[model samples]
Target: MGAFGRMRNSLSFTPPDLQEARLEPVRRRIVFYIPGYDPEARTRYRLLFVREWTRYTKRFGGGRREISRAELSQDGLVQSWTVSAPEQGDGAETRYDVLLWDDIVARDFARSRFLSVALLIVGTLQTILSGLLFRFYRLSWKYGNVILYPFVMVILLAALSVAIAALVHAHLGDWFGHSLGLPLWVSLPLGVIAGLVWIKAIEAFLNRVFFWQLLNDWVFNWQHGQGRRPDYERRLDAFAEHILSSVAARDEAGHSTDEVMIVGHSSGGLTAAEVAARVLARDTSIGTSGANLSLATLGSGLPLVAMQPAAARLRGEIARLVTDRRIVWCDFHAPQDWMNFPGFNPLHDLKLRLCGQPVANPLVRSARFRDLLCPETYRRVRFRPFRMHFQFLLANERPGAYDFFAMTLGPRRLREQVLAPDAYSEPEPAVPL
Candidate 1:
C-alpha cells in the first residue's frame, strides 16, 4: 500500500483543461493509424494490436474483442482490419487502416555507416545551432536530453574507443614486438585494429539498444524539417487522399460513418498533423461532412521538427489545423515519456494563433500512465524510455481515464474523451429505481 501511494505520488501529473460536454456514442468508426519512425512493417503492429487488445478485454472483462483477419491493400500502401465488440454499448465496429511508410524508415536505417555518422553530425549541429535545442530544454528539460542523447552517446563512445586504442598502443606495443620479433611500428597498426574492433563492438551494442535507430530518427527529422525529403511529402499527399476517400465512403448498410479518428503515435504525430491539414486543404468542408472527424496524437514528437525555423511549412499546416477549430484535436502526452512534450498547447506554445487566426486546439491531456498501470508494472517500466513512450499505444494494466483500446474501439467518440474525459471515460453509478 505504501509502495502504491509512493508510485502514484511520484508519477502524477496535472492535465490540461477541457470543458465538459455530452457526446453521442459511436456505432461505427474508422481509425487511421500512423506509426512513428520504425522499420517494422504493418504486420508487426497488427500482431501487437491483436495481442494487446486481447489483454485489454481480459483486464476490463467487457466481452470478446473480435478482430478480423488483416488485409493488405492492392497498392500495398495500407494494411487494414476490422474490430467488433458485440456487447459494448450499442455494439461497435471499427475499421483500422495502418498507413505504411516503414520502407522509408528502413531505407534511412540502411544507410552506410560513414554516411549515417556524417548525417548524425550534420543533424546535431543544425539542432544546436538553430537554437532549437535550447528551446527544447526550456520547454522540457527531459525531452531536451532525448534530443541530445545520440550526440552525447556518440562522443562518449568515440572517446572510449580512442582511449582503448591508446592504451593498447602504449602498453601492448613492447610485448607484441618482443613476442613476434616484429618492429615496434607494427604496434600502431595493431592499436588501430583494436580501435576498429572496439568500434564494431560498440556498433553491435548500439543496435541492441536502438541507439543507431534513434540517431537515424534525428537525421530524418532534420532532413524532413528542411524539406529535403520529397518522398515524405509525396507519402503525406497519398495519406491525405486515402483519408479523404475513407471519410467519404459509406458503410455496407448505406449509412454514413459515425466517426473518423486519425491516431498518430511518436514521430508519426507530425505526419498525422500534416495529413489532417492536407485533407482540410483539399476539401474545406471535410469536418462538416456528417462524420465526426478527430485527430489524436499520442506521445508525439511533432515539436521536434515543428519548432525549427526551417519548418515554416509544417508550422503553416499546424496553424491551419489549430485555427480552423472544425476538426477536434487532442494530444495525449505523458510526463514520464521523455520523447514527447506534455502540457503542450500548440496554439500558445508555438504561437500559431499569433501566426494566423486565434483559436484553441489540441486539447493537451496527460495519459496518466501511472494511474492506468499497476504499481509493479509502472515501476518496471518507469526507467525504460522506449517502453514508457510506447505505453501510449499499449493496453493499460487497470482501467482508467486513458485506455487506448477503449478510446479507439469502445463506443465513445474520441471527441467526447477529448472534451470531457472525466465524464465520458467511465460509466456512471446505478441509481435506485
Candidate 2:
C-alpha cells in the first residue's frame, strides 16, 4: 500500500494499546535575576509561588503532578514536576508538582504589579492604534448652506492602514493558496505593495497623532514612573540607568560585568528598546565598553511607539542612534499569531528597520507561538517550530513552554535538561540583508 493507505488501516473508535506518550516530571535549579532595586519587585517574586503553582496546574490538567513546599526565610524556592497519567478514552490526565525552592525567579511579583499591569494595558491599547487613527468621513457639514471639512493626517493614515491590512489579509491567502501555478510576478509584488501601504499608513498616524495621555504615562513609568509619566526621553533614560545600576550591584564582586538583558513582550518590546538606547547614550559604560546591553523582544508591538507625539530631536535621535555592535537583539515572531508582526501585522518590521538599522544593531527573528488552543482535544496544542509568537514570553508558564524558554532565555538562568528544539521554533536564523 501507498504511504497514505497504511495510516488508514489501523483505526478503531475504542481505545487501543498503542504506545502512549509518557508525561514526565520537569526539574531544574537556577538563579533568576532581574535588574532593579524595587522592594515591590521582590514582593511580586515572592507572590509568584502562589500564582504560578495554581495557574499552571489548572491550565494543564488537575493538580496531580505539581508539589510545592514552603520555606521560613524571605527568599524561597519553587519546584515543579508532572506525574504520569493513565490513558483512557480519547483523553488522559496529567499531574504537576511544584516544590518550594530556596530561591525564586524575578522578584517580588506584587512590587512590580504596576509594571505588569501597565504593560498589559498597553498591550490592549496598541490593538486600537491603527483602528483609531483614521476618519470615516471628513466631508463638509451642511445644516443650511455653509459646509467645510478637510481630511486630517491622522484620519487619512489610519483609514489607509486598516483598508490595506484588510485587503492583503483577505486576498493574499487565496492568491498564494495555489503552488505558484502561475508566475510569481502577479502575487509577490501585490503582497509587498499592500503590506507596505498599510505600514506607511500606520507609521504616518503614529508619527503625527499627538501622544495619547495613556501611552505617555506608560512610557513615562516604564522609564521612571507610570500613568503620571510625561512625554520625555529623560525619564526613560533614567529608567535605563536604574536597571543598569541594579544589575551592576548584583554582579559578583570579583567578576567584571557590563550588560543587562531587557526582555519585553508586545508593547514592552518597543518601550524597552527605545528606553535602553537612550540610557546607553547618556552613559558610555552602558553601551561602549562591553556587550552588556541586550534586547529580547517577543510578540513585538513596537510600531506603537511611532503613534506618540515625538519631537524633531527625539525622532532624530531614534533615527540615527547606533547600538553597540555586540548587543544581542533577538526578535521572536509567529506566523499563526493574528497580532504578531510580519503576518497580519506589518508595523513591527518597519519599526525595527527605522530604529535598528541606524546603529547597525544585529536583528534576528526566530519562530515561536504557533499552536493554538485545541478545542476538540483536552490536551493543549503542540508547538510548531517557527510558529509560537504570542506564547513565547509566556512559555515559561505553558505546557512544554519550558523547552523553548530554556534554550532561548533559559540557558542563562532557567536550568532544565534537554530543551527540545521541536517543542518550539526560531525564525530564519538571522540572515543579513
Which one is best on TM-score? 1
**Window of ten residues with lowest summed lDDT in model 1:** 3-12
CA lDDT for candidate 2 = 0.36
**Runs in model 2 lying further than 4 Å from the true structure:** 1-235, 250-252, 255-259, 287-291, 307-323, 343-359, 362-366, 371-390, 396-404, 407-409, 412-433
lDDT values for all models? 0.77, 0.36
Residue-level lDDT of model 2, residues 22-75, one tens digit each, is 133222211112212222232443355345434433554332432334333222
TM-score of 1: 0.88
lDDT of 2 at 38: 23
Candidate 1 residue spans exceeding 4 A from truth: 1-22, 167-190, 251-255, 353-360, 425-433
Error of 1 at 204 (Å): 3.7
Count of clashing residue pairs in every prediction: 0, 47
lDDT per residue for candidate 1 within 328-347, as digits (tens), equals: 78788888887887766665
